[model samples]
Target chain A: MVSGHSSYVMKHHDLPIEVHDLTVSYQKKPVLYGVDLEIEEGSFVGILGPNGAGKSTLIKTIMNMIKPNGGYVKIFGDRPRAGIKRIGYIPQKESVDWDFPVTVFDVVLMGRYGHHGWLSRIGKEDRNKASECLEQVNMLAYADRPIGNLSGGQQQRVFLARALAQESAVYLMDEPFAGVDAVTEKTIISILQEMKKAGKTLMVVHHDLASAKEYFDQLLLLNMRKVAFGSVSEVYTHELLQKTYGGKLAVLSEMATEVAKNPEP
Target chain B: MKNWVIIFGGLLISSSFLEAKQIGSGEDLNWLTQAERFIEMKDPSIRKVALGALLMGLSCGLIGSYVVTRRLSLFGDTLSHAVLPGIAVGFIWAGEKENFSLLIGAGIAGFAGVCCLSLLKKFTKIHEDSSLGIVLSAFYALGICLLTRIQKVGYTDQSGLDSFMFGQVTSLSSGDIISLLITLLLIGLFITINFRQLLVTGFDPQFSKSIGIPNDFLQFLLWMLIAFCVISSLQLVGVILVSAMLVIPAATASLFAKRLKNYLVLSSLLGAGAGISGTFFSFLGKGLPAGPLIVLFSAFLFLVILFLRPEKGIIVCWLKARSERSRIIIENTLKATFKILEQKDFQENEITSLEIMKKRGLSRREVEREIDKLASSGFCTKNLSANDEANLPPQTVMILTPKGWEYACKIVRNHRLWELYLTNEAQYEPDHVHEDAEKIEHVLGEKTVRQIERLLKNPKLDPHGKFIPSITDIHQGNLPRPS
Candidate 1:
């Protein structure tokens, strides 16, 4: 696997995330329209948007969880399925049933599913990798505890640890800080920064405007479409944020919000 | 009217076996003798039936783990009900109760039911629950019409077809058991081959897709396996009660398991356990159907787990809360005693009950009762004053023993330190910290107390300008305690 460095980008090579005129819809209603983006390697990017602004839709489309109707997503200049093994995804915590009969360790070990074959038993290397990820999130103490027995913060950390154990070059996190305690938020941000330092690209869907400036080096301002995408000081301006959050696309936003909350396959 | 007649006829046949045994004995069947007969495994027919029950339980319970966990309990019910038509068609096509014909027909009908569900979801605006209800009742009605029509035709080979509705476990031949054995082996091998991928897909589909897992294929395979399980167990548990076998044993094991592997293993055991016990009791009563009897046994098992299991059980949670409530009460009483001593500037160790009543805002009787509780716990002693008999009754004064004084000081320190910490670390207003600290003081562990002290730099004064007692002063029970 090629290291995700922008030296390749400077040589006009494949970007970590390359999207051109992507359009996505659900139930014959559009959620994302004509969005374009290119993310450099090792950049800590925060996608700041209001509810139903298609932030999650964009990430899902990129991962091929949802296909774009208009355009396409390319990771390192290939189709998503071909490049999906190089990406780690941490979905919203509310998306899963915590009452499932699986321990924190078992959840983390699931991150290694892509690394090994389906028939092979979970080896010792996978166990060690999972615990290492748990240790990074300060959840090693709760590794043996059932997922339902954990608090909300611990559940969030378990998913984050799973993402870490995936050991992918690109990480996509959806609302990692939502519903977690202040201490857990701090730990997650620090880990994201560490990942950025290690030449890994990180894209986080963040809702808080105040912390968005401090947490991310780049910001992807989105509403129903791409309002702005650039450095935090440039795209995070008040004018652009107002344009993204303003109710110009009321019908589109409302329909997309309902669709996102009750997604059907 | 016809449906009701068919159902009643099936019931009458089920109960008639017991009537024959009762008439032979001229009384109730001997339960002890039946139990000995079952345990001896001396009869080949009895052994075959028992083995058949055990096999059904193991496979249904194993597959049921996935059914409940995937939120497909209702789907399992619909699928089981929908296979009735296939069973009837297979019986007519083969001109007998042929296992191979029945298996193929059931598998086709089950798969067709799933396909219909997908089509309904894709083409129509009808929701999932309504679609399932339509398919289940529709297929079931078709099966009922065929069954009643066949009985009207009156063929000799149709003599044992009613057993399909409510199983006649005694009628299971060795051929039936062999087919069931093969089906279960296939289910086991499939699960082992695709265990990790199936688990990840079940828990989180989007995440699985991101990792390039073929989620749709795995789900289709799982649906097929569920159909196989229901089909194989039909002769032992029957169609109407088959879903109970799938859901109950898994739910029973979920109470004890914290992981998927444990859920699978423990559910299989509980399934086997219910099977043996139900078969035993059915043998004992001499008239009980295995379907209802097995379901009842598993339901009883679930109730036991709900009430008696450790940690997550309702009874255990109630008991834990009760103890926590009493501990909070004890801590509050100790804090009241400390505040009484503080009001006097720590000039004495003994406090009058009137002072406690005023400090704790309790009635005089309440204060005396609290003191009695403290005395019994070895925290304090109660003495009657000489002037107590002067005013129609003796006056009570409580003297704290060293242990009592130590606890009192510790409670005071915890309260003050929490108040200080809230104002400093949490940025709470000074006046707002007391109410929150009221609850936090009782639960703060020693490690947290040390952290609070360190963060506050060992403050001697709380937000309200009260002197925070030290642990050493608490142990010494010293009046006018030093900083």
Candidate 2:
């Protein structure tokens, strides 16, 4: 298999994420249609779109949590399943069961599961790493607290600490600023900036368009398909944003629905 | 899978050929004698029954923790019911009640039921609960029909077969006990080896998948283990009540346990405790079914924990609420005293009980009780002699101690500051601010009060033109006259 993939690996080895003509649908409803993207190794990108514009779908598809209907995703020149270890995924806060019987520290320690085999015990180094990550995110004081006892912003911080514990090269965060207090939002953005300065790649799904230009270096404005992808100054225009958030193009969406009705042969 | 089937087939053929012991009926012995016999363990049959119950309890409790945490309690019930038809088919296939054959047949039926449930969810629009209902009732009805047909066929060896509905502990065989032990071992090993994986998957399947946890395989393995638990426990607790064994102990443990590991350990211990106690109770009576007794004991434990556990129990919550109410009443009385002192422009340090009663809208007797409560708690000193010397109608005059004066100043400050802030910052009407401040004053912490103080720029008076006490005045235990 290594011999077979040597050529393809040599070509796309520099890209942190490569998506070629990705299409995704949920229960016969097309969410993303024939979207393509290539993310740089150390740049911070923000994904901005309206609700139901498939921003989350694109991230989930790249993570291999949701399989695309067509095309493929490669992370560091390998399939998502094999290469996902290099990526830290911070899922939406609402996707978890807050009442689950786990403490903040326990959730963060789970980030190290991929580092060792399932049967092996967690080593002292792993524990130290987890503590350091929690300290970095300013959540060490809440390490023993049950996840349910935390406020909304504190809960988001715990998830951020967990992702930081993974120590991955690339990160994909889904709405880290949603429902967070202004102070917590500032704290999380500063941490993301620090991570980027350390040469880690990041892609965040952002809801607020007002802060998008300041927080991210590159912006991917998307609707059903990719509307624009470039530096913030290039893509953060009124016309492009209007195209992305105004609404889906009537003809394109109608055709996408038709194709969904009769899927590929 | 093929190899497993072949090995199981071989075991069934060999086991069926062995001369199996027929289950014996319990005699109507005295209660004392039965209890002593159970403890002595001299009879091999009694020993087998005891071991079977223990093993069944251990396995059910371990698997049921996952079932309850994953919200699969109803699925456990459906799977238990769905295995009944397989037991009947196994009996017919072996031409008798062979334990190995029955287990294998039940396993097959459970696997099929799971497959059907998944297929229905994947390909159709039917909800999971409806699919579970369809599978549960349909298979249970089929099993009932088959069992009745076997009875009508007049098989002489089918006398003890009806005990599968409501378990008879005396009918447990040595082979049944062995099967239960194996199931217990399998469940224990599975949970121990995959504790972290199972936890992550159960808590967040999406994140687990992203990190290469193989969530689907782990879920399938969990279902298989749950099926094993249900099948092996059928001879001890029967089908209808097995799901209770899977849910009640775990639910009881969840009341106090904050971690999954503790929850699992406590649940299994409770399961074993309920099992043994239920067996003892059944032994003390004549012809009592052990299944319902076991289920009843677990349910009773659940109710006990529900009402009596320390952290979140009903009684604890009620006690907490009661204490909070009394504290609020004390604070309000102090605030009322501060208001009376402020009305007099801090000229007097004592207030009569009649003045407090009229200010608080309470009767004279209630006012005396409040003064006595305040004095006992070291907040004030009560002087009835002064009132008597003044020729008053036996009114109690209370003098506020320094502690009392400080507390009263704090409460009044909180109330007035909140009222002022609400009127000025929140734009609330002056009348509306009082009612809200009335409640907020009792619960405001020191930190929040400081924040409010800073936000309002240390205002001197409230919206109602009342003096909002300063911190230095509160510390000094002396109020300056309102300007």
Candidate 3:
């Protein structure tokens, strides 16, 4: 397999994520409207948008979990199914049943599914890879404990661990720190930063505006019909955020003040 | 013998030989005598029928545990009833019920029904439960229609095949016993060898699938087990009552066991016991149908266990609550005494009993009883002193022992720490953090309390500006309320 760093851009004779006029919909309602974007190799890109702005939908479309209504999305210059092993996905924790009776070790082992494929045996090597991944997230101590028993921060670590075990060059994470504590958030961000330094591409759907600049080197600001994409210093302007948030944030602050007065018991 | 058991036993005993001319007529007594002598005579026919019912019930208990726990009882019910048409077709094809073609036809029809359910799920937008309902009921109705049509043809002796609706154990030949025993053995082997895979698939399908376990193959295995359970159970409980055999024992076993292995073993025992009791009850009830009797016996045992089991049992919880309420009265007395001391009106040494009773909402008689209990428990002392005001007795100072002081301080400290943590660490509004923290305080431990305290940077005051007593001060027991 070609290393992701050598192929930062398709135009440069190397492809990371290639898409052409991708249109995705769920039950006839369009989610991605004639979207076009390319992610270069080893780029630490953050997808920034308000809730329901298709940031998650975009990730799903790229992963091929959601089929495009029209056009195409390719990962690593090929159809997603042909190269699923080269991509790592860290879905929101709520996507899975938290109460499911599986250990952190077992959850991490699932990352090897794409590599092992269907009906193939998981060997001793896979177990060692899973253990190594858990150690990276500092969750090796809790590896044997049930995933359900972990705190929100610990659970997030295990998820990151699972993604690490995938050994994919391109990592996609959706709202990794939405409900996590500061310690866990910092740990996850540091891991992503380390991955970026190692010449691996990372795309995170980030919600916090304050930490967005520190966490991401590049930002993709999106609304339904409008979009802004560039470096954090170039794209993360007040006017752009206001446009992406659809101007509701001004009213949202007023509402926050009003709600804070009655202090929602 | 119980009347229910005798009736069922006689029905089972007489039905096999009842085809004989003399046996059906004046030799009814002779058949009974023969059954009694058969045991002593070591008759293979009697042994065959007895062993057939036993193994059939055992298999129903074994595979049925999964079927019932996974909640496929009604699906099993539908497949069993649907197999009637298959049985009819088999009989027609082979020109007799005894041919191997019948079992093959039944298996094919059952597998077909399973296929229909699967196909409906895959192709249609309809929900699985709805699709299952449609297929199960439709096949059963079709089978009933076919059975009615088949009745018009000759071979009216085939009418007794309706006994499959309510199992007729006496009719099972030695061949049936061997066939059932073999099916039972296969099911047992399948469960033992694939126990871990089945457990993962049953508990968490997505995780199992994600980890590269063959989910579809395991599902096929589960469906096959259900099919075998339904088919074998129908021979004893009949198509309609087969669900009872599949569900009752497993459901009862779940009440007692948490682990999968324990659940499987207990369910087997429950199933076997229900089966034996059901068979016995049917024997005792003359002319009573065995299918209904067996289902009723299992249902009775389920009801008995539901009401009488130790944990989560109705009567036991009620009893525990009543005793706990009595204990609360004594604890409340200690609390009241401590409260009075906080005012500084009651000195450190002792105070009059009347002063303590005055603060309580309870009646005079209730306060006296509570005080006696507290003094006996060493929580406080009562002042039997002469007081001038009416008949009011002076209550002695309620001084807590070192252990009591520490326990009280822990509860108070936890409540304060939680209030601080919720406001600071969790970012809850100052006004909203106190009530929830009140309940959480009782359950938190020292490690967790310390963790929260450290996270909040050892806040001296809570969100409401109330003093949070320091742990060092709490150990000293003279932690003053903030002025």
How many steric clashes between backbone atoms does each model show?
2, 0, 26
Q: What is the lDDT of residue B54 in candidate 1?
A: 86
- By DockQ, the better pick of 1 and 3 is 1
Model 1, span B1-483: residue lDDT tens: 967787566445444433211101223758888788778988787677778778888888888999989988888988987898898898889988777897788888888889999999999999898999999877876776676667777766885666666666766777779877876898789788888877887788778888888889988888988998888887777777789999999998888888888899988888888887777777776456666788789999999898989988989999999989877777788889888877777777778888787888899898888888889989888898765556656668888877787787888899999998988889999999999889888888888888888888888999999989866565565646312
- Of the two candidates 2 and 3, the one with more favorable TM-score, higher being better, is 2
Candidate DockQ scores, in order: 0.60, 0.59, 0.11
lDDT of 3 by residue, B401-465 (tens): 55544454566567778887887778898789878875686568788988887888777876766
lDDT of 1 by residue, A171-259 (tens): 98899999999998898888889989999999999988768878998888888898888777566554566677784546435544544
Regions more than 4 Å wrong, model 3: A1-158, A165-190, A194-265, B1-77, B122-124, B149-156, B172-214, B244-327, B339-357, B368-372, B375-483
Residue-wise C-alpha lDDT for candidate 2, range A35-116, written one tens digit per residue: 8788878879999888898988999999999999999999988889888889999888777888888889999998888787
- In lDDT terms, which candidate is top? 2
- CAPRI grade of model 1: medium
The all-Cα superposition gives candidate 1 an RMSD in Å to the true structure of 7.1
Summing lDDT over every window of 10 consecutive residues in candidate 1 chain B, give the lowest-scoring window. B17-26
Q: Which residue pairs in candidate 1 collide? A: B388-B394, B388-B395
